[model samples]
Target chain A: MGLQNAINGIPLEWYLIVAAALFSIGLYGVLARKNAVAMLMGVELMLNSVNLNLLAFWRYLAPESAAGLAFAAFVFVVAAAETAVGLALIIAVYRSLKSVDPETLTQLKL
Target chain B: MTLQQVIFIILAIAVIGSALFVVTTSNLFRGALMLIVAFFGVAGFYVLLDNGLFAVAQVMIYIGAISILIIFSVMLTRGMQAMIPRNAQAGSVAIAAALLFLILLLAFGPFRLVVDLSGVPILSALFRTESARVLGGVPWQFANREVPETYIADFGRALVDLNQFLLPFLLVAFLVDAVLAGAIYIARQRKPAEVIAEREAIAKEEAEELAALQPQPTAPTLPQGAIASTADH
Candidate 1:
């Protein structure tokens, strides 16, 4: 079969390329998307792309060290906590202003 | 041109498309949904890279919790369906674009192809004995095995091992607890009167909508002689 080579089925650089592209796309979202909640979603995407880069390096190059894998695991916990607090704050803002637009809340009125 | 490469290409496209949709869409609800799809694609990438542990974690934490929380916020806020054109700050968009272009130039630059590939054993069978060095990383001496077999076990051991990662492990737990308490305290800081007032306002709004839905019942005229003769007749 021409499929399923045990090692090097794909190059490490390809993974990096894709990960970098994904990260850039996420950056576009973060800076461009107007809604605050969507902006947070963009942040999650960027964080995830970073984790992908870490894990790709670990799996392909440094299989012996657990450092990269451990770092990715830590990122998971941080992302979860961040989302919780971010969403809670968004809800609080919505309750006060009755809107979630990022432009309207320019001042620290709330 | 192997089957694995083919699969990787497809996944990369799916992931990029969904991620682009997540940011580009004006409908906030649709953006959240696209985010879920993008997260699933990332989990699939983890599976491709043989990190089943991270794949499960990705799905459980990102799709299970974060995406749902975002959708809930979108639903709770008004104007979820009404598409609003983003008031894109031109300066910020320009900055984000320039930053992305620089990163792409650095990453996909011409110099990357000239780098030596002698160290990685899995990909380079001809140079099995030599150590392979990638950018900014320690030279990896060829390990005895190819793909790691004990990933799940290794993760558990590394997580609990006192000398290695125990401190950060405990710190993460503490930080999560702090976030929980802080989120609750911060979100509930509204005064009691304000809370009651918001509740009443929401209730009144819903009641008005309900009233608008029902037709006013016309007054039924009493029977001229027999006050509405009988229930049976």
Candidate 2:
């Protein structure tokens, strides 16, 4: 209940709430932004929020286990790699159309 | 609230507010900038969770690398005048929002969170004692024997042993190289010479049309009173 007691300092549910808010915001960004690059940024934000939740749970529930740390590291690396490829694809799209608007990119239509 | 909890609340507010701003801003550049701030806030959360390494990595990667790359791509592809369109599927957005709200309720609404505040004091005590011993240059006692300072060396050597992360590290290198090659190939193929030629032809046609629209005078037209003035002279 006090600052001196680490056990009851901050509730785990608060972290969960923050994580949920972050995820929802990310979803809204993904839905609203038409630029492919912006969409990719939203996806990254979503992934980061998920990772935060995982790390928070790991630290609170099982601090002794190194698995959580390892998993978070893996997620970070994967996120970086995914963004690289995604941004490259976005660049390719821009080069072709001179614009990055998703609505105008309709060449795949039959 | 306790100081720790108070700090956490402030950080959570910063994180959530910046994330929302990043999502809702119409300017793509501003959104990217807000994303960097959001990343820093998240890293602060990481530090509060006692993960200093992760905090550093988050700042270095998300703030430094990923955000910069996104901003660069936005600038390269479109000028500042480009407007980001709003959501196209209102129905789908409403449905997704409903689902997200339900999930949040299910995940956090019913659970009571318990925090172990006493653990922090105990950890602080143990860390202080250990640090005092380390600073005093006293050898660590292990199995009733005084162990030398070479313990850290042994730990480091064991970490790099054949059964450890060597293979995964090398594999990551390979993956990065492959991604680089693929990106180069894709970039090269996106812009063909034919597209450039077509754009140039269109530009030339527009220029020619504008040139033809101008009045072509076979002889200079006299002013309204110029002929009368010459007759008077």
lDDT of 2 by residue, B1-233 (tens): 77877888898888889877776677878878888988998898887777777889899999888899888887877652366446577347646855885567454643422233334666446555435322213321212222233433443343345575456556766787887787677766534688789789989988998778655553346653688788899
Residue B34's lDDT in candidate 2: 84
lDDT of 2 at B33: 88
True contacts kept of 1: 0.58
* TM-score leader: 1
Global lDDT scores for all candidate models: 0.76, 0.70
Q: Give the TM-score of each candidate.
A: 0.75, 0.69
Off by over 4 Å in 1: A1-8, B80-85, B90-95, B98-102, B108-145, B189-192, B196-233
DockQ of 1: 0.40
Interface root-mean-square deviation, candidate 2: 7.2
Candidate 2 residue-wise lDDT, A12-103, digit = tens: 55677788778877887788777777788788888888889877766666555445665676678778877888888888777757777778
Residue-level error in angstroms, candidate 2, position B74: 1.9
Ten consecutive residues with minimal summed lDDT in candidate 2 chain B?
Answer: B139-148
Q: Chain A structural similarity (TM-score) per candidate?
A: 0.87, 0.87
Measured by lDDT, the strongest candidate is: 1
